[model samples]
Every structure is written in structure tokens, then in C-alpha cells.
Target: MNGHALELGGIEKRFGKQTILKGIDIEARPGEFIALVGPSGCGKSTLLRIVAGLESPDAGRIRSGDRELGELPAAKRDVAMVFQSYALYPHLTAAQNIAVPLVMRRLSGWQRLPLIGRWLTPRATRDEIHARVRQVAEQLEIAHLLDRKPAKMSGGQRQRVALARAMVRDPRVFLMDEPLSNLDANLRVHTRSEIVALQRRTGVTTLYVTHDQAEALSMADRVAVMIQGCLLQLDTPQRIYQDPRHLEVARFIGTPRINQLDARVDDEGVAWVDGTALARCAEPPRDRKVVLAIRPPALHLVAEHHPRGLTAWVKRCEYLGTECLLHLELESDATPLIASLTPELGTAYRPDQRVWVAAEPSQTLIFARSGERLTAAEPRLERSANQPEKLDV
Candidate 1:
């Protein structure tokens, strides 16, 4: 534990003409878990790599605790990276893999000798190394699999080995770049909990990068949503979901994303989607259209002509075990909007069923055409969802 455990100030990176990380800035306190989330190729992994000293930033300073890592090599930074591919040496057994970091740091080049240095060097440090390896293996529940090589272990097991290797170093910060990507869906869920538990036990400040919104939302203390080389929103998981700063953040966080209804702000500062007034919002620019983002579960089916209800055309409906999803092809666009409905209520729904969808005035978000979100603007309609800028995904 230390002050400003990790910080990246004005970080910028470019690959040729393509700018990957544009002035990225973030901080992780001791014991903090900050997730870096984004769409594929949005520079999330690149940012993590830059922080790990694996990739150099064209600009900006990377710091871990009190030391500046600008001139330091990866080994000198005391930062450990648990890679997406596991990156375990297939020839080495699990124990050997976990011992690699300790071996590199503690043993002199010749001290790694098979017979000479092993018998001649000090024994106290070698015993400490064994104890440290055992501690991490026990923590990760890989003690039984210590002798198995990467080729014999499952993806989840391999992931644990990678984590244990990083753990043995007891670094100031742990940088994990999509460490769960290779596991099966069920295994991913299981491993995620394990990772969270391990982080708690070790109290290591972590920067976890992933493209999966659910992974970030469930695991992170705060999530930073990146897009096109910029971080659009960073907030608690619940805040990111309920109040998004940008339309792109709103569209990226949820299971089915959010349903956007085409609407225009009238002179009276009211927004009317299709033929119904969704909310009373301040008049946006005359020619620009506002997108009303409503969470699927936020709206309910109401009686036709009911106050604040929306008329939607149901295109397809899917029945999941506990809930059903209503896919409606809005008249505004070709993309079919999805709404998650509970099975208890989905009993009344059907394909091609015309339904009235509506939410409270405070449940919808209005956005400008360019994805710039306007939250404080006076609402013009009765059902507008007024929100503060946030990112949940």
C-alpha cells in the first residue's frame, strides 16, 4: 500500500497515423480495482500494455507508487501483467511457471545452476522462495496441480497459473489484460469470482482490461469506458448503467444495450418520439435530432392511449429461462431495439404484438446526434428521463 499506487498522466500513443490512446489519464489507489473497458480495437489493451512498460507511450508519464516508470524496464517497474493468452512456458510445470518471477528476481545468473550454486549458495533464501511459491499456489488453489504442465491443464487452470506467477512477485500493482477471455462462458464466470477474491486477499491495486461489459461491471470498483482513443465515462457499475455520460456509453453497457427512439425537441423544449411526447426537454438546436435512450426493463407495457405510453412494434420476442427479450423494430431505424422482460410478465407478450412502451419522466436519456449528451437541458415533454452524466458499462 502506498500513495497514488498507480497513475498515468496525459498518456498518448499513436501507431503510425492512427492515434490509439489519446491523452489517457487515470489513477489507482492502493487496493483499488479499476477496469478499463471498451469495444474491440479501442486501445484498452494498448493502454494496459503502456502502463505495464511492455509498450512505450509516444507521450505521457507512467508512475507506480512513488517511482517514475518512464526510464525503467518492465522488470524494474515491479508491475506484473497477467496476459490474455496465459503466456505460460509449456515446457515448464505449473510450479516452475509460478516460480519464474521469483527465480529471475532473487537468483543470480549463476545461482540458477543445477549442482554448483544450489549446493554452494545460501539456503535461507531458497527456503523462502519455496514458502512464497507454496503461499501463492495455496491461495490460487493450484497446489494440487503444481507439477502439471500447461498442456495438461484446462484454460481456467492455466489462467490461475498466470495469476499465481504474477502473485509471487508481490508487486505494487497487477495489470491484467483480459485474463478471462480464453475460458468457457461458465468458466469465465467462475474465474471472475476467483480473481475478485484473489484481489481482495492480496489487496493488490489492479488495472484490468476487457472488452466485455459484464466482466468490467461485475469485477471493477470503477469502470473507464474507452472509445476511439478517448475515455468517455468512468463511474461505478450502477452509475454507468443508470446514468451514462455519452450515448455510446449508454449503448455499450447493458446486456442488449439501450433502445434508442428517434425524437425531436420541439420549440417548447419537449421531445416527441414518433407521435407521442416522451419528455419535456429544452429545445436543442433547430435542425438537430435528439435520441431518447430508454433501458429495456425500464419501460412497461401499458394500455393503449395511456398517458406517457409509447407505441412500439414488436418484431421478435425471445424467451430466456428467467426472462424474455422483446426485440422491436422501431420505425426510426433499421436496428431492432431490445427490451428484457420478466417471464412473469412476458406471459402476455407475443410476436408481432403491438404494445405501448413507456417509462417515468426521469428514466430516459436524451442525446444529441453526435453522441454528445445533454442532461441538464430543460425537458420539454412529460416522460423525459433526466440524468447526470455517468458510465455504468
Candidate 2:
């Protein structure tokens, strides 16, 4: 690893009366890739700017290793930032752009003049900077385009130039703000893997900000889900998606989005949705309103009138090659839900078809009305000596 651990504590920011960031805290271990993800205006970008020294926090401490970064100017922060715009100088060639940081940091005032600069600068310093530029450009596969200016390059090429520029500095931290958002869909996917590989090879601590959950989940070692100025959960990508600690995190993370149904947990700790029993709470709370979050893939269609399923009417059926998506509405409450099924399993289902929707007990997530996830367990099915099976709903 070639970087230092970056830490933020009690980070707060505001503009006039509107608070942009709440008491935010995050720590990125050396060489770790952390993605900051949220909807627009969620303070993700503000936090990144704070760390880069472009925007100062109203109250907080920013540190890398044992050094405090709060008071340092942006130029002195020893961090490289790749902006969404690619921010390449239109007038400069790719090689010059990649060497800008070294030129500024290594050459003196008189040594940087265009015409006389070459003569004033020592050959060794110039050669060293040139060699570094070539090395990084080659590493990024942009060596062939070194003499081309930004205006003549494609979006992906310019993006590579920007990345090479950042990597050439060998900064203690890398701050990237939606750097791949401008690329085409296929290119975005390809570039994502490249960036991940590059980060691993260089071992630079990175904080990437993106609104695309797919990008965040696929590329980051850890994901920080921020919402309405608060960082709700920070954990491994799998844990963030599968074991979200908060309801908002659950709702914001999945594709086709997680289905949320209105329900209430009875005094028996069993949650009920429209008269059908759902999951049970690990520790029962008094009768209270709760929400059940189930992913599309967690839901399955059963035969109509099945005892263990909720009655639903399919509103629409989308056939997507290998899989199918059935959009359904509960018969009792008309709550909207989606279920994922294999093509063979869903081919017979049509719009307006009546079916039963059932979720795996272990896959159902229960959350309080206040947006906190409640510990979930399987609801017990009781059968006394002479009585038939009955659910503790």
C-alpha cells in the first residue's frame, strides 16, 4: 500500500440555513476504496470537497495518518482529484497535462517560462518529470495519445488523460467525483474494471462519489450510503445490500427497488401484512406499525389461493430474456410489489392474472415506521394437541 489512512470526524457543513452535511464520520484505511453514494444534493460531493480542501467544513477534523488536513490549502493537501468533467486543459497536450503537477512542484518561477523555461530548468528535473509522465501514460494505455490535446480526444481518451494526470502525482489520497459518468454504458463498465485494477496496483486510498448504485456496489471495497446529509451505513458492498441497518439504505440500494409494504407488528412479535403473517421480530416490541421490505428476487408467485401466500393481481409482466418481472398489486390492500421469475416459470403468467405472492421468511426485512431495521426471525406455526396448525399472526 502506498497511501495513508484518511479520517473525517464530526464533519458538518451548512449553506445559510440549510445544512449540507450532518455530523459525518468516516475512516478509509490505506489503499482501501470507499464509494460515497446517495441521491442528488445529499452532501456526498460536499464531503468530498471538504476532504480535498476545496470546501472547508463548518466543524470537523480531517486527517491523513498523523497529519491534520483541515488547515492545508488545496494545492498542499497531497491529494489528487479526478472531476466528472475530466477537467483537462484544452490547450495542453496529454503529456503536458499529466506533467502539470510535477512541473509546478519541481520547477522554479523562472524555470517554468515557455521559451526560456527549458534553458532555465535543469535537464535532470525535466527528464525526471518527462519520464514519470510517460510511465503513467503507459500504465493507463494513453501513451500513444500523449501529443493530442483534449479537444481532439474522445470522452474515454480524455478521461484516461485525466486519470493519468492524477496518478502521476502519487498523492496520499485519490478523490474522484463521478469520473466515469460521461462515458458510454459499455465504456463505463470497461473503465470501471480498469480503475479498480489501477487502484489495486497503485494502492492509493480512494474516496469515490457516485449516484449510480451499480457503480458504487461493483467497484468499491466498501460503500458509504449517504441520505439527506447523513451517512446511514458504511460497510462491505454485500453487507450494504443484503444486511442494510436502516430502511432508507435498503430502499435506496437495490435495482427495481426493494418493495415496501405496510404492516404492523402485534404484541406477539409477529408482523402481519393485510391479514397475512410476515416475519417475526427477534425481540418483540409492543403493537406498532412497521414496514416490510422485500427484494424483487425474494418474492415468488405461487398458485392462486395458496395458504402461505398473499393474494395479488399481476398489473404487468415484463419478459427480459433470461428472467421475467411481474409487477403485482395486493388484492386486499393494492400495495404494489414486484417479483422476479425465470422465463420458464413466468411465461404462463399474464397481465391481470391472479396469483399468490410469497416471500422467503429468511429474506424478508422488517423495519419500524421510524426507518430503522428491526431484527427479524421466522414466525412460529403452532399446533396444539387437538388443534390444527395456526400462525401466531
Candidate 3:
């Protein structure tokens, strides 16, 4: 926890009888970017609001550095939020909107008057406010568009202005909820890179929420995957994709997603589908149903059919410019299998053509019927030497 700038411990949120978030925990270090990602109804946005103080949790604690911000208002928490909508004033120019935060903080309580505020402005305070606004606008690269209103600017420009407003306050942390959502695909990619660069430049801890796994995978220092109001797994993008804790995380984090296949385990811990045994298998209950997952990229089409793998028939071919995605249907179970390759059509097989799909034993992942992941481990015995516990027991 020493390195963490924002910590949400055992956070639970509910509305009457409905639970939106259930015992969620997240940690973001100083100058670190964290992405909260889940499906549309999985409460990712609600959790962000809790961190922003826009929504209060039913139970649990949220802390920043050494201070516990359990119930602090948004203004008092020294945290800034940029919403997806940007929420800018249509009448105020970008510079005016950016300057509003500085004005509120620097001006005297009575000097906030629109017309007479100029008269009461202390010269030093006015200069400080203007300097701060100009500095943030320049940092955000919106100095050229400062005189334009929200309607007159592009979507990306408006987002920059909103960020400038947030940054003008020099907040310790930033809370962004789908800030790139409103932009088009190309612009979204550009803005995502900009936001990541800005976070690094400002050195502000940020908590971002989005349903896009690609966005989370590409930009976040750590990605937290939530499902049904519970945090499923939190790890780096590579770990979340390669070493998922369970079957659901494996399916949700990838682009085309990993294939989850039904399998049967024999009495000797060997996995089988229609009497064909797979090698290097993890041990599960004898004669129990299990799940075998192989990512699309891990499987290959073989010329000779063997007893080790299942036989599949090509159902459809989809060309996605970079690769040809072949949808293969298993002959025995009729399960759909997907294989992607770099536009290499070896035989020009038509639909319903038989193809032998094979994957190495190390590439396959096995999960129990209960959705618990199985990892290969060697059996070792350990005695509690210090505790004096008997190994026989």
C-alpha cells in the first residue's frame, strides 16, 4: 500500500435491494493509470463515481495517500473528474471554462460578481489565475482553441478543454469515465494515446472506466476486470490475457476470445473427448466433465488427422483484411471453433470441408466444470517445522 495513491477497500454499493458493486478492491499507485473494465451493467461506472464522491458506497473505505476519504465531497477530496460528455458550458469559450476553476479558487467570496469582479480583482490574484489557466491550456494543447465554444470545436478538442479544466485545479488524482467514448474510431485511438501521455506528463494517479477491453489493455498500468458486480481479476494486460484465473476472464479479455470446449476426464486424470486422450493434462475428478480452452492463435490446421485431437469441419470463412478467420464446427459435438491466419488458404477448401485441427499440449488450458482454473504443479510435501505440526495429520 505504500506505493498506492488511491485505494478502495471492501467497497460495496447498493440501491435498496439491488447491489451495484460487491466488495470491490482496487489500488492505483502515484503516477499510475488503472482501468476499471466490465460489461455494460457490471457497475464499472458506478464504482468510478464512488471514487469521485458522486456516489456513496453502502460500506467500505476509500483512501488517498494517508488520508481516508470515506465520505468526502468531490470538491474537498482534491480529485478531479472528466465525464464522457465533457459537460462544458456551451456559452463559455474554452479558455473561460478552463479559467472558471481558477476563478472560483482565487477570487474573494464577494468578488465573484461578473461585472464588478474585474474591479475587485487583486492584481496578483488575477495574474495567478490567468497564468494557471494559460499553463494548463498550453499543456493540453488547446491554447489555439481557447476562444472557441464547445459547439464550435471538434469532439477531441472539447475533450481536451474538459481535461484542461480538470487539470487547471492541479488535482492530485484524476477520475475519467469513458472520456474516449464519444470520439470516432480513428479519433478515439488518437485521444487514447493523448490521455495516456497526459497522465504520464502530469504525474497524476488516474482511475478510468470503460467496457472496451482493447482500451483497457492498451492504456492501463493495471486492468481490473469486473463481472456481475464483483472484481474477477486484476493484473497487467498480458497476465489477464495469458494467465486468467478462471474461464470467464479468459473469454472476456481477448479480441476474438478463447474457445471454451467441453471435455471429459478419465480415472487416471487424462482428458478425453470421444475416447481421444490429450497429453500433459491437469488432473481433475475422474469421469467428470471439464472445459478445455485454446486460444485461436494457438491452434493450427494439420494435414494428417491423428487420435490426439478432434476433427472439425469448416463452416464459414471471413476475410478481415489482415487475416482469414475460419469457423470450424466440430464433427462429434458440433461446437464452433475459430482459427485465424495471415491470409493463407492452403487448399481452398469449400464450406463443410473436413479439416484436422491440432494444438500442442502446453497451449491448452483446462478448467473444471465449476469454472475453476487448473494449473500444472508437482506434488510436494511440506511439514510445519516451526509450528511443530505433525505431517501424519
Candidate 4:
């Protein structure tokens, strides 16, 4: 079955005095994999529940293709949700679990009983259900485990059973709410690739919810970042990382977190950090304070006393074999800064060692006092007389 496009308009959810979602809007093209990601309590899961018809929105509407799903119960939405808990029955075998949807949907009430139901059910209908279950099991490579109950299966195997159950329906849309969260780290990584491949092969319109930013960035065609009940940005992984529209979006998408420094725009339209002029703002706020955000990779360690460089004392270092992260305390403003370096280069620095940090202006992000990103009309950097030459380390 082909996937259907999903559209969510003006989606709002509230619980008494608290609002969980605030007028969210999103559209997924047919067969697209969209990841909804945010920190805990950010309402990403609530939004996914709304899409699955498991939770009702106080306002807004959900549509799949031309059909509006606002009034449909969870069973009638033509959507299949693979929940985080696997939700497998302990007594049911894998094949039985996978066949539940079909059995419930296709069988009469009398045909659902134990021994009598099997005889009462049509021979053709029973064969079709069994054949479909086997097909799903084979596709998931779990045919051997069909006889094993969930109690005997591993987490990943049980997760596959959950997926197989969802796949058996061949629903128009797939909703996964942290389906891999229960897996161990290595298994989670392996299953991530498997899930992406499965989605591509099935071509199902999928909405995956997770609190892991890395998972969202690595697996999804597009990612929606929500925070405090608001959808902050929705775009490809590259754009979400490189061209975030808001300060909160910038702060949430990257590892080690983006560095924030207090900065100001001078009367001459130049942005300065710790008395060092870094770049020219497109629309400078005269003598107004602002926040400058720089990604860890964009900040390079330079030799001590480099011109226009900010002096920092290394407070700690974390070596991750492939690379090293230096935690620094800037002397000028006492702001914490982190710089990622190749292991070879990072090993040369030790705690309490003083160094200089410089940011590539083009990669730097400027935010207004209100926490909105400032767009540069022109390139942010202006060739400065004291600008340090590119460093090797």
C-alpha cells in the first residue's frame, strides 16, 4: 500500500491551565519520514499522540490526504502506532501478536472465540490471516520466533514483533513513539538503520517521536524541533543544524551545546565580544547588548595572545578517542566555552593551561536580547587589521 500525505493545521492541546501544544502546523509529503524531537516535557510525544488519534487536540485538525481525522476514533483513523512499550501480550506468540489487528478487524464476534471460533470462522479467512502473518514474519526475519511469546524474546525481537503487527495493517500512516528507546545503546543504533530501511522499503508516511536529537538528525528526511509546546523549526537535518531560526533551536540541536557569550553592537555597526570586534551586524542595534552563539566545532583554539582572540583557561578536557573536548573559562567575561579538537591537537592542552579562542564569523550566530536570531544582510565578517591568521590547531 502507498503512503498518504499528512497535514496538521493549527493543532492545539491544553490540560486545564497548562497548554501542551501551541498552534502547531506541519505537513509531511507522501512516504516521508519526519522526526518530532524535543527535550522531555516538550510535547513532542503529545503531538504524536494527537496524530495517532490516541489523544484529542483541544483545537486544530488532522488530515491524511483528503480525509479529515479530527472526529475519528483511534481504530478508524487508518493509522498504526508502534508504542514505546512494545505493548505485546505476554501469553501471545509472535505470530499471534502480529495477527491481532487482522483478527479483530476481519473476524465476527463469535469467530473470535477459542476452539469454537476457529471452527466457526471461514476456512478461507483463517488461511488468509495465517498467510499474512507468515509473510510479515518473514519480512521482519522473525519467522523462527513466531512461536515464542514475548517473555522469551529479546527487546529488539519484541520490537520487531510490534513493528510486524503494525506492518500487517499496511496503514496509510505509521506513528512511532520512541519505539527504540527500550533497546540498549548498540541495539538502538542498529535498529535505527533497520527502521529507516524498513520505512523506505514500505514507503509509509511515518512520524517518529524521540527526545534524542542525534537520532532525529541522523534518521529523518526532515525534523521538527519543538520546545515549550511550540514547533521551533522544521527542516532538513543540515538546515536545522546550520540555519536555525531561533536561539532555542540553535541551543538544542547540537552536542556539547552551542556556546553563548554576552556581546554588544557598537555605534559603528560592529559586533564585539569581550572588547574584541568580531564582525559587522547587518542591522546593528546601537550600543545594545546581544547574545552570540558559536558551535563547538566553529570555535578554534589559537596560540596565546593572538590578536582579537579571547583568552580562556582550560578547566577540563574530555577525550573521546577520535576527538577531544576542552572546557574553557574565558577570562574576559567568565563565560564557559567548549572547543572540539582532533585528538592529536587536544592532547597538547592540559587543565589550567591558558589558550586563545576565535570563532569563524561566518559560522557564528547572533541573537537579539529577546532570543531571536539576527540575520546578516551581508557576510558577518569584515576583514579586520588584527584578525589572526588561520591556526593549525
Candidate 5:
């Protein structure tokens, strides 16, 4: 089934005197998967709760398609949430758990009582509910576990049961809050693909919340980065990584973290680091200090005396099967630097080995001290190879 467009406008939430989410706005296109990701206590979960109606926004509006959902209770909103804890009833079998939503929505109170309720419920209604539960269980590949209680099922099985329960209702919007956080690493990876596939097959509008960057980057059509109760950036994964709008967004999105180095812009807008010219700012801020952010992959190791490289000493090496990380310290100011390399290249370096680190000019980002991203002219070396060259503005 096609899903409804979900919109959250100027969402704000607070816990007593502390604000948890500041004026957050997101418009998720119908059938799109959006991931809300950030470090712990960044209000990712709180925003999801607001959309699910578990929590009320201190100020904001939530809508599905053309309908205003702010006044609707959780159950009547036609939205389904699979929580971090799975929230399955311990005493209920998988089938029963998956059938709960349908039963509550379709059966009268008198027809919900144990033995007497079954007699009061029509055979057709009972058959419909049972059929729907089995259909959802099969879709999630958990039909075999339908007879077992939650305690007897593995974490993955229970997670599927939770998913089936949510999907059985055919919700217009689906919310998942770290649904695979409890699984083992391998299973978490495997289940991530499963969830993405399921969402695609059902064409549901999904909002997934997690602190895991990998999950957010790989599973979402677009990712929303939240920080300190504020929405920092919301864009496609590629843009979020390569074209971040803020220093905080750049610092939070990458693995091993993006390298931030001290820099200064002169009267002519040339940015320099340790006396070496790096880039030219578009709007020259005379005598202003700034930060240069470069992803690890944009750095390379060179001969110690290479003119274009920054002198550094290798501190250690981490060999991650397919890639390696060289932890280093700048010889000029003892600043920390990291370089991602191929396994072979990483193994060639040793602790205390002196090397030079060079960055790709096109990949460097300039940011003001206040964490605002800055524009810069394309950088190129203009002087002799042995002398520092001023970046042309």
C-alpha cells in the first residue's frame, strides 16, 4: 500500500526546565524512509515519540497527508511504532501478539473477554483477524515462531514479531526506534537489510531512530542529524558527509571523525595552517581564526620531507581488515591526525615513524570558530615546489 506524507513542523519539546527538542521541522515524502540520528540525548527518540503520539509536543504540529494528527490519540492516528524494547507481551504467543492491534480495533469489549468473548465474536471476524496475523508473520518470515511466547524466541525472532504486529495494521506511517540495537553485530547488519526491504515492499513512510551512523547512512533515503535539541541538517547521506552545512554536522557524520585542524584567514582571505597556505575564503575575514575539516580518506602519507605535506609522526596503526587507520601527531604543534589507508599501506607504518600528511584541496572544508561552514575558492599551489604558496582567491 502507498503511504501518506508525514510532516512535522516546528516541533518543540521540553522536560521541566530543560528543552529536549527545539523547533524541529521535517517533511517526509510519501513512502520515503528517513532516519533520525544523533548521539545520545539529542532528542531523536523524543521527536519519534511525538509523531507516534506517545508524547505531546510542547509546540508544533504533526500531519499525515492532508489530515491534522495533533489532536488524535496514539491508537487512532493509524501510525505503528516498533519500540527499542520490542514491547511484546511475555504471556502472549507471537500470533496473539501480532493479532492484538487488530483485535482491539475490530472487536467490541464484550467480544474481547476470554472464553465468553470468543463465543460472542462472530466466526467471520475471528477468521479475519487470524488470517491477518498469519499473513504478517509470513511476510516477516516468522510464521514458524507464531506458536511460541516471547521468552522462548531469540532476539531476532522477537524483533520480527514486533515488526509483524506493527505491520499487521497496515499503518500509514511506520516508526522504528533502534529496533535492531539489541541484536548481535552480524544479526544487526543482516536485519538492517531486511527492514529496508520490508519498507520498500510495503511502500511505507518510515521514520527510523538510531544513534548508529552506519544504520542512518545506509538505510535512509535521507538522514536528519540532530544535536543539542536542535535539528542541524537534513539531506541525502552523500551531501551530509561531503557537503555539511555546519562544523558540528561535519564532526558528527563520519567514521573515525573528521579531522579538524587550527587555521587562520589573513587580510587577503588566505587560510594558513602552521605557516603553510591551504585555501582562500570566499568572503575574506581579516585576521580571523577558523577550522579546516578533512575526512580521513582525504589525507595521504608522504615522505617526511615532501614539500606539500605536513610533518607528523605515526603514533599507532589500527588494521581493520579492508582498511587501516594511521594515528599520528603533527610535529609542528602536536595536533592529532588520522589517515585511512589500504591494508597494505597501513601496515608499512610503525609507531614513531616520521611521515608527512597531505590533504586534497578540493575535499577540505573551512569553518568559522562559531561552527558555521564557510565557502572557499578552489585551492591550488602557485609558488615553487619548495616554498609555501598563497592560495589564489
Candidate 6:
């Protein structure tokens, strides 16, 4: 089946006094996988429902290819939705469940009549549907479970059945809303790869909605982050993590959360944190306060006597096998800072141990007071003649 590009223009939705989606716009290229992710009540699922024609938007238009989807009923939209619940029929076997859509579409009402419908239905039609069902089941590796009912299947097995049902339709677009949320942690990870492979093999344009950021980052070609009824950022996972357009995006995309420290830009356009020079800004200095955001991995711990580093007291250390996270409080301002350390280096420090921390100047991000990102052209290092020499480690 050939995929078609899908577009949403200025979509808006509201219920009573509460607004859910606020003039959101997005597009998915043909055969591309886009993930919509956000916290609870952020309208990620609502947006997916709107695209599937399951919910009406207060404003805006949905278009697939050159066809306008306005006023199109859910059945006529030609989009297949795999709901979060799997929504499989408990009484029907997997094969029969996957054949439901075909039975409704290919058989006439009179041919669908209980026992007599089997006699009335054409032999060729029944054979065709059975073949199609088996083909999809095989693709999902659920051919052996086709005769089993929903109650006899595991969560992952049932999920595969639902996907087979949707795939059998050969729709222009696929909408999946948290299809992996019901599975266990290991199963969820396994199923994520399966779903991505299935989508690619079928060349289907898909939109996946989930509250799990890791799933979105790992599975999608592009990710859209929604918060408070707004589409905060939409970009590749790498760009979204490395260079977030807004402070909210930066804080939401990373683990251990991005560190926010109060800082000042001096007359020489130098950004200082706890009296330690961090980076030189390209923007003209106004002696105004700004918020500096640094990821935990970008900050490194150093000896307490390092002159260019900020002296801090280690508050705690969390060892996670692969790495350690050190929580420290700056002595100059008492602000909290977190540094991701190697397992070896982290084991040497204990709580209340005095140390110094410095950030990688190139990796630091500066945000205005209003939460907008401040672009830096060049960042120069600051040094003092009388202070102890700086240490690279």
C-alpha cells in the first residue's frame, strides 16, 4: 500500500471553559513515522483522535495528499486506528477477529446473515479473506495463535492481532495511540521494535501517541512535544535533545532533567555562575540576569582547588551501574547542580565532600528570562592571573 502525506492546519479544540488543543499544526511525510508525546492531559491523544476523525475539532482542517478531510466521517476517512486497549473481541478467534473488517466490507448484508450467510457468500470471497487474514497473521508471527481467542492470548499476542486487523485494511495512514502501554517493561521494549519494523515493511504513514518520552525518542523519525495545549517543539530526537528551542523543551526531553542555574551577563558579555566564568555571549551585555541550562552529562567534577570551577559540596551520589549522578550544592550561592560521572570517578566522592564543578563551554545553553533560547556566536574562556591554574580533568 502506498502512503500519503497527512497535514493538520491550525487545529483547535475546547470543552466548556477548558481548551485542549491550541491552534496546533503538523505534517507527516509519506511513509514517515511521527511520534506525538507529552505528559498527561497535554492533548497528544486528543490530536491523534482528531486526525482519525474520531473527534471533531473546534477549528482547522485535515488533509491527506490533495484531498480535504473536512466533514468526512470516520468510516470514510480511510485511516486505520489501533486503539490503546487493543479492543479485541473475546469470543472470536484471532483469525476471525482480523477478518471482521473484510467481512463487513466485502460481504453484502444479505450474505452476512448468520448461518445462511455462509451458504450465500461466494466461495471465492471467503477464500480471498482467509488468505489475506493468514498473510497478515504470518507477518506478525501470530499464525500459530490464529485459532485462539483473546482470553487465551498474552497481552503482546493480542496487540499483534489488533495490528494485523488494522494492517489488513491497507489504509492510507495508520494512527496508533499508546499501543505498547499495556505490555510489561520488557515486552514494551520488544514490541516497540516490532511495530517500527512492521510500519517500514508496509510503507505506511504512521502517527504514534504516547506519554513515554523514551519510546518516542527511540521509535520515531521525528517527535512532537506537546505541553499545556501547545506544540512546544517538533524535530529529530537528536536536535530536540541537543538544541531545544525553548526552556520547557530542554527541561522535558532529558533524564536527570536539565539543570537550571541563575546567572548574570556582565558588561563584557560574560556569563557567570557563582562567580565562575562559564561562557562569553555574542549578544550585547546589559548586566541582566539569565537562566543557564546545562545537561548533567555536560558538567564535570574537578578538584576542590581548581580556580576556574565553582566550589560545591557533594550532597548525594546515585550509582546506576553504567554511570553515577552526583548532586551538589554550590558554596557561593547554595544552588543545586547535578553532574553525570563515570562509575569509577563517582565512587571516590561521598556526601559533604568538597569539590569543584565546571561545564563544557560549547555544550552550555543560555536562556533569556522569558525562557527563550539565547544563541551564542563564540564562547571564550575567562582566567585570572593570581588564582590557581585551571585543571582540565
Task: Give each model's whole-structure lDDT.
Answer: 0.83, 0.89, 0.81, 0.88, 0.89, 0.87
Q: Which parts of model 3 have CA positions greater than 4 angstroms off?
A: 1-4, 279-287, 345-347, 377-393
Rank order (by TM-score, best first): 2, 5, 4, 6, 1, 3
Q: How far in Å is the alpha carbon of 183 misplaced in model 2?
A: 0.8
Could you tell me the lDDT of residue 157 within candidate 3?
A: 92
Give TM per candidate: 0.92, 0.95, 0.90, 0.94, 0.95, 0.93
Lowest-lDDT window of 10 residues in candidate 3?
Answer: 384-393
For 80-139, candidate 3 gives per-residue lDDT tens digits of: 889999999899999899988778777777789988878898888888888888898888
Error of 6 at 299 (Å): 0.9
State candidate 1's TM-score. Answer: 0.92
Q: What is the alpha-carbon lDDT for the whole of candidate 6?
A: 0.87
Clashing pairs in model 6, backbone N/Cα/C closer than 3 A: none
Using alpha carbons, what is the TM-score of model 6?
0.93
Backbone clashes per model, in order? 16, 0, 0, 0, 0, 0
Worst 10 residues of 2 by lDDT: 383-392
In the range 1-393, model 4's lDDT, one tens digit per residue, is 498999999999999999999999999999999999999999999998998888999999999988998899998988988999999988899999999999999999999999999889999999999999999899889999999999999999999999999999778899999999999999999999999999999999999999999999999999999999999999999999999888999999989899988777765566677657665567776447677889998899876665557888999999999889999998865789999899998888999988999987787788787777886545444446663433111
Per-residue accuracy of model 6 over 1-393 as CA lDDT, tens digit each? 588998999999998889999999999899889999889899999999999898999999999888888689888888888989999988899999999988988899999899999999999999999999999999999999999999999899999999999999788889999999999999999999999999998988999999888899999999999998999889999988998988888888888888887777766666766557777667843546667888999998766666457888999999999999999997876788899999999888999999888877778888877777887657665564543333211
98: Cα error in model 5, Å: 0.2
Clashing pairs in 3: none
Clashes of 1: 16
Residue 114 CA displacement from its true place in model 5, Å: 2.5
What's the TM for model 5? 0.95
- Model 5 regions more than 4 Å off: 304-307, 380-393
